[model samples]
Target: LPLKPTPPPFRNHGNFVVSVAELNRWLGERAEEAGAYVLSETVGAKLLVDDDYEQSGERSAGGEASGRDRNAPGRGRSTVIGVRTGDKGRDKDGGRKSNFEPGSDVVARATVLAEGCWGHLTGAALKGLGLAAKDPQVWALGVKEVWEVEQPLDRVIHTLGWPLRPQARFKEFGGSWIYPMNRPGETPRVSIGFVVGLDYADARLSVHDVLQEFKLHPLVRKILTGGKRVAWGAKAIPEGGYWAMPRLHAPGMVICGDGGGMVNVPKLKGIHYAIRSGMLAAETLYSSLKAGSTDFSSYERAVHQSEIGKDLYESRNMKQPFGRGLIVGGAITNAMVVTKGRLPGGHWPTHRDSDQPLLLTDRDKRYPKPDGKYTFDKLSSVFTTGNATRDDAPSHIRIQQRVPRELAEAWKWMCPAAVYEVPEDAPQGSEHVDLIVNPSNCVQCGAITAKGGRLTPPEGGDGPVYQVT
Candidate 1:
């Protein structure tokens, strides 16, 4: 047998890590090169829908779609035909500014949604089209930073159980990652980050602060001894595994990537799945368009029978056990791994992140203050993300101005971008607080959406301008 020659730049052969923002930019460039128009700063605000399924009574009296009609309804069987872009240049009160521009409609035969975790429009499409999964989607907040380090770490590292409480009652489940990002002729770099499940019961737990504490550990400190942080970012991750995945296709549209809950929680990997799902979606769309039909029922079948479905099904019960705490969850996870997910055998129900009740307690974990070097405050971290959000832009976050002290505390601490604040002037001894929202500080991480607030799209390109790798 003849052996195949390995490609040049062999180091890029195996599992590698790259800045997600950088990868996205390169992909966008590649897409543009392929004759696809890549719109920057534009946001898909509303789905242009057709009420054919509803008007035609495609659904039975029980709301189940009739044979071959897969549309389910959060409200009614509204078919997503395309998207409406969000209006720009709106004032804080939503008044048109001098430079105001009305949003435009972009019609298409098919629309593929690849919005990242907990996307606003994704929520709308999921409900409007009745594509929700059996189990509720869960989320975790990830705060990451890239640092220029003196000591170049060659291998990737993952750690668990220090900053987070391990007790089942705490409901804490997460870990941290450290990966080398060394580049030729450039200063040695490494990416360090931490993820915390949003289901934690602690009202004052801060993921950003936890990452700061993670860097202080002697083992982590050694690797980052002379490092200076160059970038910062935060995001929400959908960790609902297979059971939480919604229907992938609806009339005139298909959901792909994280928006479809394609992440494999066990491997902490979703990029490959996202890419693969996108490719499948492209194929499905192409075929549908070629056949002169908007019926994308085939897309759903294609995904379920594809590698994406197979991989997800294998680890279907992976993330649910974590809600019972790391100990029980880890034991079940180990059994599932050993038995190839056959041991669990059935669907383990999950809850939405916001459904977890946060308690106000004197036993809250206290985090160390940022040292301005290894550790950092939320606002300073936002600065590193190159956030250019206008101070006067309309608030895209939707939450009550006044909320219970416990909920207020949760939002204040949960936000890594410091968008929520319990004002200093809040009543001294009240059980409620006036929640002040600083939308300008938001990095559009979508974490708030997981824990009791809604995040809408800002003006096109109004959020953080992530740096290229």
Candidate 2:
């Protein structure tokens, strides 16, 4: 690690890393074994609200399943009861194909939203149900790659500074991590990645490009001397801590995992918090059902009192100080850690990622050009993720196609999947420029959603097929 003054990392013998995708597959199998019907190749397009509920089949007048009456009482007050799966076999023009099948409503007594970071339905529920957090949720973009290294990395290594400027004016907040993937007998492998706060002020800062630059550092290059990059992907993380966590529950519904902003940024861990919150949600739902009650508010209370809430509360103001810059922010973070978040204790405010000012700095010139080996471009990076999105699939990203040149460049560099593009001959002035969107190139990282754009779910079974990430 090439950090200035070489700060000692918080090492623990209990810490270990595993393939998330593989773990998920194992969990799915266990769930199925427990009699849970796991539906594959399906997308939950939208949450089914009780006030506007509509079923797909015909009704028998005797309390049978059917579409809801639009004129029924409580039409304006809605509660999420379940989800509607996305329609399949629709052409690019949205016309029905021979095998077209309309989406069916999978109604449930209680719906739990465990959608990962920046989920589509989670955003809808937050806005439609008025589940507001005290502060707006902030985000970071993480681009990562796995490599088959020649030498095994015995332990985890984290680095700060070097690729990203540490000056207060830069407003860059992030770091890189390198971890050994396999044990003694297995092939030597390592997972290396970099994360950058989405609120960065530079108009041309690219999280992916920064990662390429980070790999070129002497300390990093030594680890990947003769290695070949295997898998690559990007994802957005919610770093707004406790104050930014939305109300965890609504009528007949509960939100869990990254969708509820349970991540503790400093520790760089959220899986445990997500798991704990999930267990509490399950208990609350079970009790509600057994008591024949419709209220799900108990779940929220349980979360606040549980370990997840306490952990987040202690680090609630951690990420906010970093908005001031790495040095001052780092100092404040250290002080807060020692004081257990009691130092400077009031709620700290945060700005939306898009609201951050994009200054016309020359930072873009510092990015390294890909050399084909250790560093690569976005298009090449996307290929390694096993992306299989159909070329003719409807666009899932929503943003103004025309915007100021500065914003255009920001989007162009911000995306790690090469989804956004500006014409090469476009004038570098204040005029609006046409931004081309290659939606098929998207890996469903959800970065756009955090940076002034919206990401809807693509057709089921499309997008990247991550196996070991």
Q: What are the Cα lDDT values of the candidates?
A: 0.80, 0.81
Candidate 1 global TM-score: 0.91
**Which consecutive 10 residues in model 1 have the weakest lDDT in total?**
56-65
**After superposing candidate 2, which stretches have Cα over 4 Å from the reference?**
1-9, 52-77
> TM-scores, in order shown?
0.91, 0.92
Residues 1-469 of candidate 2 have per-residue lDDT tens digits of 3445443224535876988888889989999999999878888987888766432211111121122221222223466778999988787777888888878889998999998897677777765666757477788999999999998888888876668888877789999889889877877999999999899888889999999988888888999989999888899999988877887777788999899999878777778878888899999999998999767888888988988888888888888888788889988887787788899789897677888878768887878889878889999989988798888777777788888888888988999999999988777664889998899999988888777777778888898888777
Quote the lDDT for 340 in model 2: 86
TM-score winner: 2
Which tens-of-lDDT digit does each residue in 226-271 have in candidate 1?
Answer: 8789888898888887878888887788888999988877777789
Query: What lDDT score goes with residue 124 in model 2?
Result: 71
lDDT of 1: 0.80
